[model samples]
Target: MKYLLFLSCLVISITNLYPASAHKVEVSGDVGGTLHIEPNDNPRAGEPSQAWFALTRRGGRVIPLSQCNCELAVYAQPYAAGEPPLLEPQLEPVSAERYKGIPGAEVVFPKPGIYELQLNGKPVSGARFKPFEFKFEVTVAGGSTQNSRNLRDVNGDLVEGESQKLPTWAIALPILGFIGILVVVLQNMRRSGE
Candidate 1:
């Protein structure tokens, strides 16, 4: 009984570390991947956010950047039929171990609202992999004081590219909170055992 209760609490705490809705998996016949957005997947306007794709082909084969010709586009809600994406983020290969060499980008939202990110890709050469497209909806919070300026790189280049590292405190707080919750749960278990 104690083991079951402990396991239940453990699972609950682990799951709370990230909201269930923040991560999304998209699959197509040719290729598929889960899109990851950093800073808890809730980006803020005017701030740089890291986004990447962990892609795989059929049979769970990893898709490296050199093998894919990919583009990523971000659009505001209520997307128009003939309009271009609000932002066409420049794609670079991420260095993350699990996502190493996968297409990734840094993006900044100009406003707080619902946004759509569309990822399209095909084999770099030959008939290696079929074309694939994946879409993800993101709800951004906060607002940007300077929308026009936020869309550019530091050198004033326009909407073609962007990471602010989170503070240590921001990282530490959640871990501390999780520890506090675990303590309380363990205390309760001890009392119940008595």
Candidate 2:
């Protein structure tokens, strides 16, 4: 039936509306797990982006910020030897699922390009997750990136990790939906005229 075909097309288009938001796994010495960046993977230039780390050990014990002396340093990609870090954002403990009191910070990319965020941590008191130095390569796009943490959303409410900018599916799905509707209408007209 035409209706059934239209419903199927609608379902397919709706399912592609979400973008990938998986936390990135980092390669470090003994203390490292996942790193999550707010507002999606590719942060844009001239906006504050929040980044956090979820560290675990062999037994999967969570490493809280209270137990580690961590430092974050950012460097431009293709960095030269002995070059100083471009910026060093202060580390703060952020509370969230699996990242309760974990090391996090806000960073603003000055321009669009490839950059590396490096995290080095050591035990503050007793040895927690062993010393680690994690590196993550982040690509910055040339535009203004806004997130709920730093800006108002569609509902004028602040919700972490949500961006106001329209997503790829938001643009594509509407076009596809319109086309599907048009097809259904055309099919109905043809049948009625018969």
Candidate 3:
């Protein structure tokens, strides 16, 4: 009984250590620098997501955010018909060297696919860097349009499509297992008392 309880606790602890859908990607700037973007969460269709960016020189020196005015432009690659509309993301300084995508200003990915993100800005404080422009190819995960059930299927892939619901058994099974363990522990205690 104690062993079962210990194992259950161990399993839950281990699972909590894994990240819950944050995605980070790095792109090389045209001026021999590195741009790192960490979307607060995995990009989903029609759902608001904020991304943080950090610009560092080739030798690992951070660039002051106040010295530059930055803008983000996202273009969905033409997947179906005519050219998709270009989306301009609102970026604001979160710190001296970091910028965050503003809530309403950030573009929600219309669908899951590759997007071309252009980060362009000019140095306002007489920084030696030229007008910087960095482009990155980002892939967004598909999300269901009808409901907000962020569940993975049996194959461990994100479940997409309308009319698809997360299986109740998936949630119930873990709870049932924990209850079963507790019942077994109580029974063992009762038997030992006798």
Best by lDDT: 1
For residues 54-173, could you state the per-residue lDDT of candidate 3 as single tens digits? 665566555555666777778887444455437887776554234332112355788888887777767676765567777666677776565545667899888854575557876676
Q: Which lDDT values do the candidates have, in the order given?
A: 0.81, 0.80, 0.61
lDDT of 1: 0.81
- Candidate number with the higher TM-score (2 or 3): 2
Per-residue alpha-carbon lDDT of candidate 1 for residues 1-194, written as tens digits (9 for 90 to 100) = 66557756765665464456557789977688788888767788889999988889888788977888989999999888888999999999896655678888999999889999999988876537788999989889874445444476678777621234467876777677667766887788899889
What's the best-to-worst order under lDDT? 1, 2, 3
Model 3's number of clashes is: 0
- At residue 52, give the lDDT of candidate 1: 87
Best by TM-score: 2
Kindly list the per-residue Cα lDDT of model 2 for residues 167-190, writing each as its tens digit.
Answer: 787788777777777787788878
Which stretches in model 1 have alpha-carbon errors above 4 Å?
1-18, 143-194
State the local distance difference test value for candidate 3: 0.61
